[model samples]
Target: MSIKRPRTGGAWSWHQDYGYWYQNGCLYPDMASAFIAIDPNTKANGCMQVLRGSHKMGRIEHGRFGDQTGADPERVEPAARVMDLVYVELEPGDTLFFHSNTLHCSDQNTSESPRWSLLCCYNTKHNNPYKESHHPFYEPLEKLPDSAIKEMGSKLFEAKTDFWDPANDETVGTGKDQ
Candidate 1:
């Protein structure tokens, strides 16, 4: 499941882990995505929250702006943490849609539940992994449709995609197709 912020805010924001694709004006993903919950999420437990329209910020220099909640003190604006953030709560099967740049975070698990959530992102074949390290995870791009691509500046990413198998206990990285 996804998270959402209160209704009072600007249009959008941006980040590294997540961000608004300026190539595409809309924040809602052009590609398809899914949220999976291993356990229920609640306000008492750690739940996902999002800042509406926070993606439009266009990649803020997190350290230049000044943010302290970062897990890495030295790496300012590390990944998605560089963008604005909002906390979201969720229940099993309660899915929410967010734009690419939407700033979001998972709250602490105040409840007994594990609050597990699987965030799967997809794009067109034309779209490639933002980071070189992510290359091995995706299939090759060949005549990928526009609907399948999420535009980020000159870069492109697969939009219409699905995980062959998530690396969970049963699907451990044995190097075989899940």
Candidate 2:
């Protein structure tokens, strides 16, 4: 999950999460992510922007942009010129399910209110990584009822969460060899 704080939030360059994931050893691009809005998401607050149906274009070349990996602008620029741009504005509690290869980006937040969101990523069992990487290998997920969330309450946040240390991460910078 990630949060985009208002006024100080930075922009995400146009890129697909799978563009980098493919280099992480995933053989196929069969993955998805759920973006759950924790706060109102609006263009003024840097709501996600997507090129409609760009996933059909498949993964484009990705290269470094500072500490971030972004899609090649040479290819993205042509697509942006012909594709319809969609501003994914959402109300709190609204959820957006997107394919991993979907080309998406966001502008810097210029609103007074924050744009907080949680992104739950999922990978298909058949698309398991050939080797371990920054993401997890395929494992059967336990089914939980909707009420489980409310029942857990504050206890959920108390659980020890394993966070990725970028300094130790081999997924970025090293390219496919990682």
Candidate 3:
């Protein structure tokens, strides 16, 4: 929900676009993707499947969008949906990292066992990425001590709207990969 920050549907998108793209258009350009399986992932249990480097496929026409592909009677890439996707079978502690543009989706839990996982996304920090009207955008984390806040590189954006009377803002981007 926080990935797109406050844009399109903005804070009003808790359950809507956050999970399914219920709205016609709201998804921001994807930056990174990660998923953690609470229960080990498997085809029998409906684990996630991804199309390797699909995100890098030169911006395939988004059928869901009002693009030319949107109204095509046949899918732009019907085979790509299943054939191009790679099934992910993971160990309990295993982690998979991939480019943000990777096309990925999961299967149904046909197995009797339950599955749990955390899908994390990383994005390029844009300067004032939020929609113009959605000012004071915030995605909060648990309270951090001042020392830790400095360590994390957050900076104070505003004292007027941020939750804490005194706020901490990290100037993100000093980390390793990014």
Best by lDDT: 2
* Model 1 per-residue lDDT tens digits across residues 1-178: 2332232112111233333232222233444445565556555555565545554553432221222211222333453455444555556666666555444555434354455567766665555445333123337647866765555346756877454433432212232211
Residue-level lDDT tens digits of model 2 in 9-99:
5678889989878888888889998999999999888899999989999889898866568898998999999999999999999999999
Clashes of 1: 35
lDDT of 3: 0.43
Root mean square deviation (Cα) for candidate 2: 5.4
List TM-scores for all candidates, in order.
Answer: 0.45, 0.82, 0.49
lDDT of each: 0.43, 0.84, 0.43
List residue ranges in candidate 2 displaced over 4 A.
141-161, 170-178
Off by over 4 Å in 1: 1-16, 19-33, 62-87, 136-178
For model 3, what is the alpha-carbon lDDT of residue 25?
28
Q: TM-score winner among the candidates?
A: 2
Give the Å shift of residue 94 in candidate 3: 1.6
Models sorted by TM-score, best on top: 2, 3, 1
lDDT of 3 by residue, 32-119 (tens): 5566655677777655666655554433333333211121224325536554667888877677776544545444454666566666
* lDDT minimum window of 10 residues, candidate 1: 63-72
The alpha-carbon lDDT assigned to residue 14 of candidate 3 equals 7
lDDT score of residue 144 within candidate 1: 65
CA-RMSD of model 1 = 13.4
The residue-level lDDT of candidate 1 at 7 comes to 25
